[model samples]
Target chain A: MNYSIALKTLVVKEVYRFVRIWPQTLLPPAITTALYFLIFGKLIGGRIGDIHGVTYIDYIVPGVILMSVISHSYSNVVSSFYSTKFQRNIEELLVAPIPNVVILLGYVSGGIIRGLLVGLVVALISLLFTPIVIHNLAITLSVALMTATLFSLAGFINAVLAESFDDISIIPNFVLTPLSYLGGVFYAVDMLPPLWQTISLGNPILYMINAFRFGLTGVTDVDIKLAYLMTGGFIATLTLFSLWLLYKGIGIKN
Target chain B: MKALSIRNLRKTYHNGFEALKGIDLDVEEGDFFALLGPNGAGKSTAIGIISSLVTASSGKVSIFGHDIKADNAKAKSCLGLVPQEVNFNQFETVKGIVYNQAGYYGLPRKLALQRTELCLKQMDLWDKRDTVSRRLSGGMKRRVMIARAMVHAPKLLILDEPTAGVDIEIRRAMWEMMKTVNQQGTTIILTTHYLEEAESLCRNIAIIDQGHIVENTDMASLLARLHIDHFVLDLADPLDSLPVIDGYQLEWVSDKVLNVAVPKEIGLNRLFAQLSARNINVVSLKNKSNRLEQLFLDLIDTKAKGAHA
Candidate 1:
C-alpha cells in the first residue's frame, strides 16, 4: 500500500470536514471560554482572593484550555466516526487496500487537530482576560497533545460501540462533562475536603488538568510524574482497546 | 489465471439463518459473468462476503490468485465493487468522492486527479462533478457510483444491480460503458433482476435458488436448454379458427390473436410460412417473455419442485 498517499488523503479529508464547519466546531469553544472567564473570573474572583498565588481567572486558564481540548478531541472523533457509520460511507475505508491501523490513525489525527485548534482558540481568549504564562513549554505541549490523543481514542471507542446518534452523545454529556467540571477546573483540589480531594484523585481528568496547570502556572496538587504516568497509561489502554475493537470488526462488519 | 475463485463459501448470520450453503464458483479473467437469484437466495450474502462487508463462517475467496484472508490488501486492491445501495457520502461532491476513492487506493495526487477526470468523463458525469451527489437524479447518482468504483481501475469489478432504477436510455448507456470496460480486459460480475441485461451483456451465467446453484453455463448453452419458445401473434386479418400446424402447438385467444409454442429446432420463418400458407395474415409477433427470463423462471421452479420432493 502507498501508506503516504492514503494517510495524507484521509488527513486532508478530515481537516476539510471540520474546517468547513468552523462555526459549529471552532466558534462555540471560543464563545464558551469567553463566557467562562467573564462569569467565573471577574464576577466570582472579585470576592475570592488568590489561592495559588494568582488571580482565580489566571488559575483557571490551564484547566479551561485542557477542558476544551478534552471535549473537542472526543467529540470530533465520536461524531465524525459515528456519522460515517450512520451514513454508510465507512465502507470506503473498509473496502480500501489500506490497513485498519491507517484508518484508526487518520481519525485520531483528525480529532487531535480539532481538539488542539479549539484549545488554541480558548488559550488565546484566556490571554485577553489574563496575561498568560508558560513555566514549561515542553510539558504544556506534551500534556495538551497527549490529553487530546487520549480523549480522541476514548471517543473512537464510543463511536464503535454506538448503535445510534444518541449513543454517541451519551458519554460526552453524562460522563465527560461532569468529569471536566469536577476535575479541578473551577477550584483547586486541595481546597476540597480530604475525602473529596481523594475522590478527585480518582478522576483521570484531574491529573491531566493538574499536569497542564503545572506546566503553565508551575503549581499542581498532584505529583507531575504520576500525572504523566496516569495520562500515558490511559492513552495506551485506550489505543489498544480501540484497535482491538476495529480488528474484531465490532459494530462494523457483520 | 482466474479473476476470482471461491471454495466452499458459506455464511451463517448471527440470527442463525444460513445464507450460503458451501457454494463453490469461479470466473475466468476478463469474463462478464452474471449471478442471478431470487431475493433471499444468498446472492447478496455471497457478494457481501466476497467484498469483505460480511464475514463468512468458513470459506476461501481469492482475487487474482491472492487469498482474501491472507493477502487482503492485495486482493482488495485488485477488486472494485458497486454495491446494490448508494453507499457514498451524499454531502460530498461527485469529484471529491471519486478523487478520494482513488486516494484510498494509494494513487498519488496527480494520478488520482487524472484518473478521476477520466472516469467521470467516461461515465458522462464530468459536468456534474462539482455538484453535491444527493442533488443528482437517480440515474446520475448510479453513474457516480460507477465512476467511483472505476476510479481505482481494479482488475475485477463487481456490480450489484447497478441499473436497478435507471431509465432505459441511461441503462443502455451504462451497459455500453460496462462493455467497454470489459472489452478493455477488466473482469465484471453483474447481479441484476433484469434478465434481459444478463442476456444482453453477460457471456456466462449462474442462476442460484434456495442457496444452491440451479444452473451454471454459458449463455448460449443456457438458452439452448430451453427446447421451446412461446409467442403471441397478432393477425392483420381476424382468424375464423386456428390453423393446424404440424410441429407448433397453437392456441386460439380470439379472432385476431393466437398463441403458439414452437419448438426451438423449428425456425420462426417456417411457422410464419406455414401460417401464410393457411391464409392467416400475422401482422406482429412478440415473445411471451424474453428467452432468458423464461429459462430463469423454469430453473427456479424446477429447483423448488426438486427441493419439495
Candidate 2:
C-alpha cells in the first residue's frame, strides 16, 4: 500500500473538514481573544503594576496565545473525531488499508494546524494591544506546537471513550475549562501563595503556558528544562495510550 | 483461486450470544455469490468479521491470499465493503465521498479523481456529483455508496443489501453494472432480502439460519431442491372448466386464470404442449411465488424443526 497517499488523503480530509466550516472553527477564537485583550489587558491591566518589568498586558500575551492553541487543538480533534464516530463514517477509515499510526498522525496533524492557525490569529490580535517581542523564537514555536500535539492526543482519547454527543462536551466544560483557567493563563504562578504555587506545578498546562511566556518575554516562574521534560513526557505517554486505544478498537468496532 | 476463504469463524458477543458458530465458507474468483439469512441470523456479523469491522472470537479469514488478522492492510486492499446502512458523511458531496474513498485505498490524487469519476458515471450518479449526499433521495444515496465502494476496484466486493430501498429501474441498472463488473473478473458477494435478485444474478449461494449454514450449493442445485413449481397462467379465452392434464394438478381461480402445479422433473415444456393440444391459448404466465423465496422459507423452517427434534 502507498502509505504516503493514504496519509495525505486523511490529513487533507481533516483539513478540509475544518477549513470548510471556518466560521465555526476559526472565527470564535479570534473574537474571544479580542475580548480577552479588551477586558483583561486594557481595562484590567491599566490598574495593575508591571510584571517582571514588563507591562501586565505584555506579560499575559504569550499565555493567552498558548491558551488558544491548547483549546483549539483539543477541540479540533475531539469534535472532528467524535462527530465521525457519532455519524458512523469512521468506518471509511477503519475499513481502509492504512495503518493505525497513520490515522493517529492524520488527526493530530490537523489539530496542530488548527491550533497554530488560531494561535496566529490570536497573536495578530494581541499586537494591537501589546507590541510583539520574542526572546527565543525556537522555544516559542516548539512549546506551541508540542502543546497542540499534547491536547490533540488527549482529544483523540476523549473521542474514543465518548459514546454520545453529551460526552464530548463534558470534558471541555468540566475538565478542560477549569484546567486552562487555573493553568496561569491570566496571572503569574509566583503571584500565588507558596502552597498554592506548589499545587499549580502539578497542572500540565502551567508548564506549557509558562514556557511559552518565557519564550516571548524572557520571564518564567518554572525551570525551562523541567517544562520541556514534563511536556515531552506527557506527549509520549498520551501518544502511546492513543495508539493502543486505536489498536484495541475501543468503542469503534463491535 | 479463491477470492475469499473463511475457516472455523466463531463470534460470541459480550452478552454470551454466539453470532457465528464456527462457520466455514469460500467463493471462487469472479463468481457472484449470495449469503442469505433472516434478520439477526448473523449475516451482518459475518460480513463485519470478514471486513475486519468486527473482531472474531476464533477464526481465520483471508481475502485472495492475505489473512485479515495478520496481513490486515493487504487483506483490506483486496476487499471493498458496502455496508447495509447509509454510513457515508451526509454533509459531503457525491464526488467527494467517492473520491476520498479512492484516496484512502492509496490511489494518488489524479488517479483517484479519474476513478472516482468513472465509478460515479458507471453508477449513473455523475449528474449529482456535486450535490450533498443528504439532499439526494434514498435510492441516490444507495448509488453513491456503490460508487464509493467501486472506486478502489478491489478484487472482492461485498454488498450487504445493496438494493434495499432502490427503485426497480435503478436496481436493474445496478444489477447490469454489477454483472459487467463480475464479468471483468471482480468477485461480488451480495446479501439481500430480495430473493429473486439472488436467483437471477448469483451463481452460488449460502443460506444461514440461527447462526449456522443450513444450505450451501450452486444456485441451480439449490433451486433444483424445490420439487414443485406453481405457475398462474392467464388464458387468452375464458374457460368454462379447467382442462385435465396427466401428472399435473390444475386449479381454476377465475374464468380466465388457471393455477397449475408442475413438478420440476416433468418441466413446463410438456405442460405448454398439453395446453396447446387443447384449444387453450395462454395469454401470459407468472410464477405463483419466487422459487428461491419458497426454498429459503423451507430451509429455515426445516432447520427450526430439526433443532426441536
Candidate 3:
C-alpha cells in the first residue's frame, strides 16, 4: 500500500462529501449552539450570577464547545459511514489495495475536521453571549482534539455494527445524548450528591467536558490529570477496537 | 502465468448454506473468459471472494501467481472487479468517482488524472464527467462503473452482469470497448445471463450450477456438445396444424411460424427434403436460439437432476 496517496485521496473524498452539503453538515450546529448560548448563557445566567467563582456564562462556554465537538464528530462518522455501507460504496475501498489503517484514519480525519469546524463555530457563537478568554490554550485545544477523536472512533464502531439506518440513530439518541447532558455540560459534578457525583465519574463524558472546562476556566471538579488520562485511554481503546474490526472484516465483509 | 486461479474454493454462509462447493477454475493470461451461471449459482460469491469483498472458507485464489491471502496487496493491485450492482456514490460526479478509485489504488495525482480522462473517454462519458452519477441513465451508470474499474489499469478486470440493463446499442458499444481492451493485453472475465454475449465475446467459459462447475471448456468445445439444433421455420402460407415427421420434433409457434428441432445426425438437407416432399415451401429458416444457450440449459438441467438423485 502506498499509504500516502491512498490516505490523502480518501481524506479528500470524505471532506468533499460533507463540504458539498454544507447547509446540512455545517449550518445546523452553529444555529443550535447559538440558541444554547442565548437561552442558557443570557436568560438563565442573568438570574444566576457566578458558578464556582466564575460568571455562569463563562463557566458553561467550555462545556458547550466540547459538547458540539462530541456531537458533530460522532454524527459525521456515523451518518457518513453508515450511508456508505447502506449504499454499498464501501466496496470501492474494500477492493483497493489500501490497508485498513489507512481506511480508518481517512474516515476518522473527516470526522475530526467536521467536529473541529463545528466546535469552532460553536465557540465563536459563544463569544456573542460572553467575553472570550482562554486560561490555557494548549489544554483547551488538546482536550478538544482528544474529545473529537474519541467520539469519531465511537461513531465508526457504531457504523460498522449497524445493519440498518434505525440502528445508527438508536445509540446517539438513547445513549450519547443522555450521557453528554449529564456529563457536566451545564453544571459541575460537585453540585450533585455524593452518590450522583460518583456515578457522574463513571459517565466518561464528564472527564471530557471537565478537561475542556479546566482548559478554559482553570476550574474542573475532576482532577485534570486523570481527565487527560481517561480521554487518552478511551481513544486508545476505541482505536484498537476499530482496527481489529476492520482487520477481521467482521461486519463490512460477508 | 494464469490470469486467475481458484483452488478448491468453498464458502458456507453462517446459516449453514453452502454457496460455493469446492470449485476450481483457471483463466489463462490475456484470455477473455466467461463464468456463466444462473441466479444463486454462486457466480457473485466467487467474484466476491476473489475481490476480497467476501472471505473464503477453505481455499485460495491467486491473481497472476500472487496468492490472494499471502500476497493480498499484490494480488488486489492486479485485479479489478465490477460488482453485479451499481455501488458508487450516487451523488458524486462521474469524474470525481473515477479519480477517487484510481487514488485509492495508489496512483499519484498526476497519473490518476490522466487515467481518469482516458477511461471516461473510452466509455464515452467524457461529456458527462461533471454530472452527478445518479442523474445519468441506467446505461450510463453501468458505463461509469466500467470506467471506474479501469482507472488503475489493473492487469485483469472482472465484470459481473455489466450490461444487465443496457440497451442493445450501448451493449454492443461496451463489447467493442472490452474487445479493444482485451486486445491491448488486459485479461477480462465477464458474467452475463445473455448467452449470446458469452458465445460472441469469450474464448473460454466455465458454467457453474448449484455450487459446482457442471461444464468448463473452451467456447468451441462447449458449443460442440449441443448435438441438437433448433430452427424457426416461416411457412409460405398459414397452416392450422403441422404434419408429423420422424427424426424431428415440430412445434407450432404460430400459424406461419414453426419451431423445428432437428438432430445433428438428421442434417439440415434432410429436413429441407422432408419439407419439399410435403409441398410446404419455407419462407425463411433461422436458428431458434444460440447454441451456447441450449448447452447451458442442458448442463444446468442435468446438474439439477443429479442433485436430486
Highest DockQ against the true fold, candidate: 3
Q: What are the TM-scores, per candidate, against the unseen true structure?
A: 0.96, 0.95, 0.98
* Candidate 2 residue-wise lDDT, A1-254, digit = tens: 89889888888888899899999999998999899999989999989968888788998889889989988999999999998898888999999998999999999999999999999999999998888889999999999999999999999999999999899889889988888888988888888999999999899888889999999999888888999999999999999999999998898998
Give per-residue CA lDDT, model 3, range A70-106, as digits (tens).
9889999999999999889999999999899998999
Q: In model 3 chain A, which range of ten residues has the least summed lDDT? A: A124-133
Provide the global lDDT of candidate 1 against the true structure: 0.92
The all-Cα superposition gives candidate 1 an RMSD in Å to the true structure of 1.8
Q: Of the candidates shown, which would achieve the greatest TM-score relative to the real structure?
A: 3
lDDT of 1 by residue, B183-259 (tens): 99999999999999999999999988877777888999999888999999998998776788899899989999988
DockQ of 2: 0.79
| Candidate 3 Cα outliers beyond 4 Å, as residue runs | none
- Per-candidate Cα lDDT values, in order, are 0.92, 0.92, 0.92
RMSD of 2: 2.3
Query: What TM-score does candidate 2 get on C-alpha atoms?
Result: 0.95
Alpha carbon lDDT of residue A148, candidate 1?
Answer: 98
